[model samples]
Target chain A: MTRKAFITESDVRALAADLIAAGTRVVAPGRVGTPLGERIEYRVANKVDEILLGQDEPARSLKDFFLPPTDVILAWQEKKDQVELTPVSSTFAPQVIIGAKPCDAAALEIVDKVMDWDYHDELWFGRRAATTIITLACEGGDRSCFCTAVGLEPSGTRGSDVLLTPAAGGYSAEILTDKGEKLVAAHAVRFGADKGADEARAFAEKGRKRVDANLGLKPAEVRKWLAGHFDDAFWKSIALACHGCGACASVCPTCHCFDIVDECEGLGCGVRRRNWDTCQTAKFTMHGSGHNPRADQSSRMRQRVMHKFCIYPERFGEILCTGCGRCARVCPGGMDILEVVSKVNEMACGGAK
Target chain B: MAETKILAFVCNWCSYGGADNAGGMRLKYPADVRLVRVMCSGRIDPVFIIKAFERGADGVIVSGCHPGDCHYTAGNYHARRRFAVFRELMIFMGIDPRRVTFSWVSASEGGKWRDVVSETVERVRALGPFEGYRGLTGRQHG
Candidate 1:
């Protein structure tokens, strides 16, 4: 357990139960019944039977738990002569996430740059410090996922504490961090001796090849192209079909724009909250005079791409996306990110217009 | 002092002067319109209008010089084109078109400014308070 080891499929399940029984939150990708069919989503799993071993990517990333869609930031009360306000605290309980996709895991680390840029986001890092991530090698991404292109492989352990690859009995577990080593040590009975040094190499190789076929682009080249094309006609044509819905932001792991609102509940008291918002809408940049910088869908679309590729990279020295492909999958309009990136890369390389 | 808070952005050369003329002539209009004067209507960014609405505006107005009479030559024309696109986006986002009003006023048109403010107040009163962006003021959930 101190080094590389082998965990049987049933042993992994037992490990999940052990974590839950010890009052630690155990989260994993599980099947939820939707109108169409079963959708895999990361949910709190209590028992071994609840965890979905290897399935499709979750409908959303782990960002939902860390950042949350909406949360209260502060509460206030007004008196005759004075106003009182109280701020929210950033503290979380220890938890374990099993079966996380590598792209999703890497997203956490990529976003960590922005969350800690100027203001150290207390809530974001609070959850990060308290949770241990165990990523499952991905093999299910279609043509939309591009984790490898953004310096992450399907089996990459960029943000994971432990990396689990499917092997003969269950998973070939590679202990990644101190937390991962501790996790294996705590459940040493579940993980057996390693079969070999490269026990899980074959499994990771196949998974990597599967996602590699999706799409690839040079992140630096795309950033360079975006830097020069702020007013390009391509932005207009590329987003022509977009209905300006912010669904892409809702699914994006790295798209972390939020609106802070103060809500008066009733009778001299209120709460200030932050909710997820996106630049895809005109309201995002609207001024008090009814003037909008990103006044049209075209400009808003360009902002989204520029933030992910150029602006974020130039400012934070890192691209703001993990290439999880959820945005393309959930787009109601035919707005495909792969097409957008490919076009930018093509333009950079002096290829097709 | 009015219960209905209306955010009005006025161009310094035209709409602002028109509003000043109305005040000088003692022309009565709804006091609900809180005015913020910009050197030119073209200086207005749609985000300012959005921030006004989000910050608890019942209604908003963007008044500037008439099409050809902009003191900045063609500043109002640029604003006109910008609003044309911004209005379409607002409608697509499910915001009521009536909640936001746009008009062109000249420096000599004090009577017109009075009428526009009164009519806009009435129209917005009929529509009632806009709580779509209530989260901004700590009033209610959006």
Candidate 2:
């Protein structure tokens, strides 16, 4: 498709500032720690440099910015004639997320399916609708990134309003939808006409190579292997060292299992909350009558693999994993899911009948 | 021998009916399995499974409709996916995955219900007792 060099670095910052001035809240990755090696922190966009665009993915995910760790859903108060169901305070302001990678935006789209499937999650959807995401294409992907493995490319514009590709000291910004058009129109002075389209394509190709190298196996093949190997011994072997810390699932960009709880505060006053839960935790599938269905690590390991590969695809026709490699990085026991899937596939192909 | 306590989380539509069918048939299976009926297999939260273990149940079974026969069309599909992952988590925690069993039992399958209970009881009996991971406040027995 045709592309345009919308804004330079200086112009991008000016556009962000203009958006903020025009009553649109801007959120971007802010720098934390010292100059030697800095960490990224999600904060409101004010300064241009604070918005880390075209860098590697952040250590933390964009999930926290939308679905917070903990929040009150509903408040209840008892009355003489009727019981009042007071909704929690929703202070969602319309905002623009600058410098979001395409992979992260795609992950949000994947999560939205489950969250909005059976139940309408107002809290998550509220934040999503109120924000316009502008994804900056990765000039170079990191060693841990494998967004391409799960039907996404580093430069793919699957779930972004505006997709910005790096060009000659500027960005070849493609207006993806009405949202992108509106965002650009809001700060028309910063945007320029088409300039370096070929350079952006070259950068995207380099980024795609890095992404493909990280993914050793195809997602479709992994799903097929998992479908048949529900009773494999590989699950027992790899999951033996698992401490069930649930760090992998918590840090994963796609793991969206949650539990809703009601907290009572004396005379019928209470708050309902939805907290993130993980299948990697031992207590995840425990029953009320004192029976734990998945009481051991081996079975738990099997469940984790099957859920991602077999069951999720059966239901949603999509693999639950984004291949971001966060689970492999964060897992305390060095439980690499890629290695596990590969081994399982090998066993299946070898006619282990 | 101490009584084997089995906790069964049955889906309201199929598995629960199967269990009820077992009762109607007067098919004598082990009385060890206690049934807790839920709206659907999808409603069987992971917390409920953990709480059952904490409360001292020796075994837990999550029974629902067959893959394609779910009353809600795909509730069992979601449940299967959930338990698949939950099983992995349990295995990592030094827990025996055999203690938890997930099976498909439709409403008409009274015979299957008996078989499930029989198999689960036998398996739990082989595993002996679950005294390993007790709750924080629960009494620990040697």
- Candidate topping lDDT: 1
Per-residue lDDT tens digits for candidate 1, residues A1-353, read 33677888888889999999999999999989989998889998977788998858899988987887887778899988788987776777888999999888888988999899889998889889888998888864788888777777888888898888877767888888899988888999998887634647776777677766776678888888889879888988988888889999999999999999876654578788788999998899899999988889999999999999899989988778888889999999978888888789888876554
Candidate 1 residue lDDT tens string, B1-142: 2368889999999999999999999999888989999999999999988878766788889999999998889999999999999999999998887888899988889999998888889988988888757554433211
DockQ measured for candidate 1: 0.03
Clashes per model (N, Cα, C within 3 A): 26, 27
Instruction: State the DockQ of every prediction.
Output: 0.03, 0.01
Instruction: Tell me how many residue pairs clash in candidate 1.
Output: 26
Residue A142, model 1: lDDT of: 82
Q: Report the lDDT tens digits of candidate 2 across residue range A250-318.
A: 777777888888865434666677778888777889899868989888888788888887788888877
Cα lDDT, model 2, residue A229: 72
What lDDT tens digits, residue by residue, belong to model 2 across residues B76-118? 9998999999999999987898988899999989899999999
Off by over 4 Å in 2: A1-3, A34-38, A80-82, A89-91, A265-268, A348-353, B1-142
TM-score of each: 0.70, 0.67
